[model samples]
Target: MIKIRNPEQILSHGDAASRKLVLEIADLTLARLDSYRRIKSIGRMEGSLLHIGTRSWDLLKKRNVYLFGAGKACNHMAMAVDEILGDYLTEGLAIVKVAEETDAFRKTKVFVGGHPLPNEEGYRASKMMIDLVQKSGPEDLFIVVISGGSSALMSCPIEGISLQDEIDATDVLLKSGAGIYEINAVRRHISAMNGGMLAKRIQDVGAELIGFGISDAVGSPATGNIGTPYAAYKSTPIGPDPTTLDDARATIINRDLGERLPRSIVDYLMNAGPEGETPKSFPHNTYFLLNTLPDSCIYAKQICDEIGIPALIVSSFLEGESRDAGTFFASMAREIQTYGNPIKPPCVLLSSGEVTTLISDNSVIRGHGGPGQEMAASFAIAAAKAPGACLLSVDTEGTDGTTKVAGGITDSSSFQSASNKGISLFRALREHSCFEALDAIGDVVFTGNTGTNLCDLNIVYVPGIDG
Candidate 1:
């Protein structure tokens, strides 16, 4: 168990309390990440295969193992595998946003790349992974490690789509307020490796493919872990083609990706699954280590309760548009304050999951933000209308969206600060610019790269409504 400073102390106006709250949230988030890390460690090859199903053990014993790890958490997961598998790791490749020359990772090939957006480096690393898969024969074993950021970090745009096209499309979709499923759906359609396409590519290599996934999405590990083409399709849109780059930008600028995804991506997505009957080839053996949001929510609830606040565990799998989700949570807080129904006053409402933002053409050239910040800012806007309510949203991974900070917190003062500065919180949110809003009020929550990625954590504290 990790100890966090009392929420009350942190919420206090004193600098010590404020700093303590930030530190405590950071600590709690890190602890959650660490717990997941431990699970990955224990699930390694040498760590008691006895508990695993017989089929998994049989697959493990096979030789000629080739490994690939992708996503934000991939570096740590790969390092843990190295610790456990040691010399048995015949050959492996890891793609992460932050790969360092640490002692634990010295033995493996680690490629540092971009996240939330695919860069040239990310594309290069992804191509290397594809090459590795293509080289493997029937006798080889392929181990693919996947986590949250894999969709962006392992990006390989398909034919007819330039890397810039994909990047531009991604930027639009993000600000367009699309959910993760929708954003990823568009991503899968445009990519060579997403939407279980990677799994399909190596299906016939005769190698026993073992996928170890740290699910950042909701359930459906294959979909959540490796990027399901179907889910991505579900999230994207079937539409009229955009004639020019300007048109494409306009489509994204005026419309929400949440409202619709690219027609090309959507069409390809619709043709997936058994009914659509594309390729049926996939890894026979796959394992998902943890779907962690539930546990994190439980932890948050316990912490809130310990602090003498009634805490409600609303849902661990919260999803949908960032602004809507924020509004929904805000409504809950409002309800408690007005009616005291679901939860009384002096209570907390906690949720975990991924929220998405959509981008349009106007800001595509100047856009910079991620989901966590969007969620925090959206919640802040919502909380602004509900007096006496304070909310905090963060990405447990310590990196929210593309920024260095995890997320932000909001109180009544957040709105006042923005108003005084001639900044409209709503306008900032429309641009998916939470950092600006939070920064203006000194509300940004900064926790540098916490080695774990479970999902987002949201806590809404409603004061003095219970009694």
Candidate 2:
């Protein structure tokens, strides 16, 4: 099945052969990243016993089994758990970035939540989840599926902090050019349902907790033998958090966001006692690590090998300014095509990481876009030097930046294509409106929740000069 919704539109023009190859690799890689299939493969129910990986839970022994999830890919993750648990599942609630018509659940209630920012609906769903945990006891079991964007998707600010204050604070931190970890340091501390707070509530109620998560942090290794219980799982809302209150304090000081963020958030983090700190350890929780940021690149490389195409996983630690990363990737394509330096022609280069765009002044933003769109737009301008080169940059979770589209794909002819339409790529990047510019030329890539969130996945194809 094709993950890219508009493949025909994307392959209509502009180095069709190269674009087709890159899209094929992307589609295959995304198919493998499906959480629904992954969870089902490792979990099965027999009679009254429920088996997940190497562990099994007897439904007869448990009073109630509840499923709670929050993230961009929570729809599929929650669905998998709901289907496997079936009649034994007491109730389920999940907060997702997008609720698709394709989503089918046996008993779970889905709540559409905001991403990149917190909203009232997410806060409501989070409160409901907290209530569900509070009502549970020692015999009850809580299963939480957490992925990236949960901090925003499962928004329940601390008592002293208003939802708007958390939202405003998140907006300020995102635009501050700080890394995701640095930003989460502040957001987690001010949140009631994030950074191990959910797990702490379950622990307080004397309930058993089973967590399934996808780690998007850079430097995380590929998930191996997911059937085995993970011992080092941390971060997210349902696991032990590695970030501390001091980390939160340091983020504000280092980013110089003391005055930029809401005063309530600043005051809460500044004055919060040690008891207010997030739980740093949850040794009793049985967790499974599904995928990491590096897994995307690793999977792409495998697809290339199966297809008999030479491929290189350039890096899984890609970060920094989005547009600049695009230019750098484009330069690499030219070097590979002209000099055959890294690998021969007709090769694929894959990378996965979180690239960010800094927007200190929101007034400069003329249109909606994300880091993936900016990178693709920047690649288009520089790719004009390298013929037959095609690049696809997407935020694997579907939406990129503030746009509905996942990201953008650009070929060597993309620059001239935009020029013919009287669109300037440079201006698009400058104004942070690459979505509009890319959409005009049918370069915008659309994938409505590809069932995984592994941050940004950049795929580039550099065909032979003669071919």
Candidate 3:
């Protein structure tokens, strides 16, 4: 069921054996981390009795059971709940980054929302959700599913701030090389829906809230006891925001984005008092953490164990400049293949986290690319030092940066391959356009809606020097 659209194209060149193995592991990981399957396993309904994890709710007592969700993985998460609730559900609305033709929903209305940048459709959906929550009463039960990208997917700016202003601010913050936490700090305080504002709206209406979320935060530990209700969950629209107004102001100042970002955002964060701070806690709501960043590595290692391949998890908190990280990974590959310091040959190096690309000048951009593409292209350039070493970098959610492709795959021969095609990989990197370079050599990965979002997953295969 887990299919890569361009597997043959990807394996046509490079270390086919190594590429095949990497693809297999990645596909299996995507299947295992599917939100629909995860939600179904813990949630179900037996007649009028609804069960989610350890808790069971009698629908006869509740007036209405409404569902709302927004994120990159919202489609699968919302679909699972809608199917489970069946006729007992009052209504459902899901704002997703992409809407697949195969996504069959009975009770949920799907909206294709914008990601990385707020769009008009998403803004309208956010307004609709706000109206829906406001009209509901105390007897209603609200079930919310949220994941990574919700900040952009669910966009409803506070009073006096236009949607374009929020979009402009997001662009500035993302390009500033600031981390997600810092970016969320500024975004949370300015949004009417984000940063627990939606949860607050539901809370004020006296409706019971139950939230399910996937944490894409770097350095997040693997989830445990997923069925148990978590009380300390924070961030996103449904949970309490851990960020504050001070954090927002600090990010703008620290990143020197005051002059670059929209004036409305900067002025609001500066002029607004304590009342502008996002809600910090929601004591009454119940939350569940499905998967974390480290879980991707854990699942990958399990695949390696089953296949009799030696795997070492380099790090789950990988960050910093994307190209630099690629070169560092290539160096590590060389060290392992030559010195045998970390581990022997015929081994795999696995890492997961958010690696960023800094694009301060918009004019420098020549073509489409993302952190994953840049990583693989940079690896291809440096990987020549270690023959036959192959690397695969992807945004686990199936889209990397601004492209439709999952990411890119490259090996030692990729540099020469590009040379043969008269494509300058170095120039491509310089212009922040690795997608065209990788695609020209049939190294681009394609998987539409991977059904999960866990930032980036990097895999490196180092064969024996003799092999």
The ten-residue window of minimal lDDT in model 2 covers 1-10
TM-scores vs. true structure, each candidate: 0.76, 0.99, 0.99
lDDT of 2 by residue, 162-245 (tens): 999988988999999999999999988988889999999999999999999999998898899999999999899988888999
Instruction: List model 1 lDDT by residue over 349-452, tens digit each.
Output: 77788776654455333344566666656666666666667667788766787677677776645667567778777777766677766666666766554555
Q: Over all chains combined, what TM-score does candidate 3 have?
A: 0.99
Q: Worst lDDT window (10 residues) for model 1? A: 233-242
Query: What is residue 110's positional error in candidate 2, in angstroms?
Result: 0.6
Local distance difference test, per candidate?
Answer: 0.61, 0.93, 0.91
Model 1 residue 361 CA deviation (Å) reads 3.9
Using lDDT as the measure, the top candidate is 2
Q: Which candidate do you rate higher for lDDT, 2 or 3?
A: 2
Per-model RMSD to reference: 6.9, 0.8, 0.9
